[model samples]
Target: MIAAAALIAAAPAVLALDGTPGQGAALTGSVPPGTTLQLDGQPVAVAADGRFLIAFDRDAGPAATLLATLPDGQRIVRPLSVAPRAWRIERLPTLPRISQPSAEFRRRRAPELAQIEAARDMATDAQGWRQRFVWPVRGRISGLFGSQRIYAGEPGAYHSGVDVARPTGTPVAAPADGVVILAAAAPFTLEGNLLMIDHGMGLNSAFLHLSRIDVKPGDQVRQGQVVGAIGATGRATGPHLHWGMKWHDARIDPLLLAGPMTP
Candidate 1:
């Protein structure tokens, strides 16, 4: 639990400039017509309905602000109050040692990286995916976004996306309308059979460990559209879908971006 003094100290009196969160709570709000919103110095899109939202990184420390600019140039700042969360930390003693990839693996991974980079460089033509997002797949959540991980008994990177555990060949759908930026078959060291979509304005989603890709690059897809099938392709112990979302270079939590997942 967060200390009462911390919450009180973090909370602001009025909308003055940028608003910050308490500790772990996310910062979210709306803006006026024709105006933009920024949270933690990242630009957020304001929908036609005047709704806008931004999320803090799960590891985000205390002391951040949310800023909204009115159409008439009026600025509103509000401090955020975030509640602390108890995290589960595990240290494995017999983790497998990761060796350098073979030359063949390196040769196969290069093109895949190039393709993904090209997709990330796509231009934002319109605000098509700013609307509410639909679930790409329905299943039990096997992994959560922002959870610290120690893979194969070694200290590994933090989990950057949500993982859905489903049977192999389960259909994977688009979470929102977007252009298919990457569709290719490659050997990924971690994420296997990956596909990425661009949702405009530096927002993107990636589907990993897929069995089949139904969409192609440059194709326009709608929310709930079946884009691929799930599988255990790359480095995996079982069949699962690894869904990741990003804002420009920042790896925002996909679950935060889309809210809670449905069963």
Candidate 2:
């Protein structure tokens, strides 16, 4: 096993890695060109230039393995120590019921879920994950990723994305380059005027509770391009942008990509 380094010879090695190394963090790195890599037994997409990305889940354990096969048929396995995170826990005696959904709503869920799953399964040539992310809208952060909420002493769903509280009509921009995969011109039962973008290699971004969408499916958008506007169009209490990200089925933290909004 070799330690991660910024630059290494054309051998089985880790060239560069960035991110917290904790759950919900997207680990972006590189290896020698033409080398094959895998994360926890799953084949990772390595671009022609050897750049790769792997994101940890919210409940991911404290360790992961990175295996690389060199051009010379040699193999190297690096056991990575993933740091544990302290998630925010909110316990409330009384809260809106999120645990139960109507049967009709549940019936409609299958198609929506399938669409989202199919969108994230896409592996495109656009290298959007290598770019620096920008905030879709500058607003007060109302919620964070991986934060759990308990209602009446029962644990409920953890927040899957960051919530930015901005007034309706606030422009929401694309954080990176991508092709618009799902642009719901009509409101979704749960996500409202939903819009989703595929950033290649099984990584995707979803913008929920949108009031208006500026892009359509198949439209290629660049960094900082406006995709929609903030709104309380779904089950939200007030107007806000719910920015979520996923790498395949593993949900990742978007703030980890965009960082804190400029004060």
Candidate 3:
């Protein structure tokens, strides 16, 4: 917990960023210590030291307003400026069958989907998750958010989250205070042994390709608390942790939610 006066004293005179509305803009700014950031109504966890980053969703429309409220009752509002980009949308001329899962795979994927849905629906009354977030795992960043992806010679979906490539069996910690909404081995063709945590107000963190799960459903975890270990499960190429984050159903960059991650 932080004092409101300390938060007010640390807040910037006015929040400012270099970007346009509706475009996938990269926003870098500072909040007062223990303040919470809301961009287009989604919660962004700040660091204890007041540093934070947030990126607009690709589908975010133009003319979005960002709201940052200090614990002391000070508020900063900034209008987003988004630049236009030409997007290439096309239907594959010849889709591969391997891209589609087999019948047996589909049978096993149902429970995984159920677990994910349950995690997404987890509710909490406490708002302590608004505090500063920490890195769950520190390692080489093997992937980024919103990058175009190619799977097995077919154009796949865009990378919706950041990937921290740590060695196999390295412990993965909770990035923020949250309840373990789902903790079980999943059979998804892509994400195996998945774990999702709800940090309240629709902000959730997902750990994929886990080798071992340390927490269980409905368990409360704090920042830097070990939750699982990394592994080459599911469709992974090697041993690593695919850390993803979502605000409601909108996928956001986890890297944007924290300061520069160091291995």
Candidate 4:
């Protein structure tokens, strides 16, 4: 199995890869032109120039396989090792509450989820995925990604994003260049004033609990552009910006892509 940033060449085909290799990690690499790529037997999108991006889910297995079929039909196989991370798991004294979904929640949630899924399914040509990501806001980290609470032996949903504790009306910037996909006209019941941006290559960002959305759908946004304001508009107790990122179906850790928070 190959580790991080390893390159292997087979005859006329060349496969070069580099990035963090672990659960919730996003890896970028390139292969020979006209090469088809796959991760664990799943077809991966390859740009015209042979550049590609792949990410491991938060609960991805320790090992994965990458297959590249060159233009000449030569197959290059790569065994990848995905390292595991220790998430912050808290244990509760009582068992999990088994509650049925409310009728209102079930009604409003279906459309909201449909919109999000449609946005993610869009294959945009934005090149933001190649750029270094920046923090949408700089402040005290109120919540961490991949943190979960366990009730008895049952595990609850882990935190999907990193939260920045900021005051209401605090302007939040776009982490990278992208086209706005979903700028909710009205607040969502749970996400509030939500804004989603597609950075291309199956990588996207979602800003939750926003007070205002400055951009509209299909608008091109650059890195550091003001896109929204922080607020406690949904099920939040306080005003903060929840910045979540996903690569296709994989929920990636934004901190891993954006690095340490800066002023």
Candidate whose lDDT is highest: 4
Which pairs clash inside model 4?
none
User: What's every prediction's RMSD, in angstroms?
Assistant: 6.1, 3.8, 7.9, 3.8
TM-score of 3: 0.68
Number of clashing residue pairs in every model? 13, 0, 6, 0
TM-score of 2: 0.91
lDDT of 1 at 49: 60
What is the Cα-based lDDT of residue 50 in candidate 2? 84
List the lowest-lDDT window of 10 residues for candidate 2: 6-15
TM-score against native, each model: 0.75, 0.91, 0.68, 0.93
Q: Point out where model 2 deviates above 4 Å.
A: 1-15, 93-99
- How far in Å is the alpha carbon of 46 misplaced in model 4? 1.2
Candidate 2 lDDT over residue span 58-89, tens digit each: 88899987787766756666667888889999
Q: Provide the overall lDDT of each model, using Cα atoms, as 2-decimal numbers.
A: 0.70, 0.83, 0.70, 0.90
Query: Which sections of candidate 3 miss by over 4 Å?
Result: 1-56, 65-98, 126-128, 150-155, 185-187
Positional deviation of 154 in candidate 3, in angstroms? Answer: 7.1
Predicted candidate 3 versus true structure: per-residue lDDT over 85-187, tens digit per residue = 4433444545542446788988877867876887787676434246666778888988876666444466667776778888899999898888888877543
Off by over 4 Å in 4: 1-13, 95-99
Task: Report the lDDT tens digits of candidate 4 across residue range 153-263.
Answer: 887889999999999999999999999999999998889999999999999999999989999999999999999999999779999999999999999999999999877
Clashing pairs in 3: 19-81, 20-81, 20-82, 21-81, 21-82, 46-132
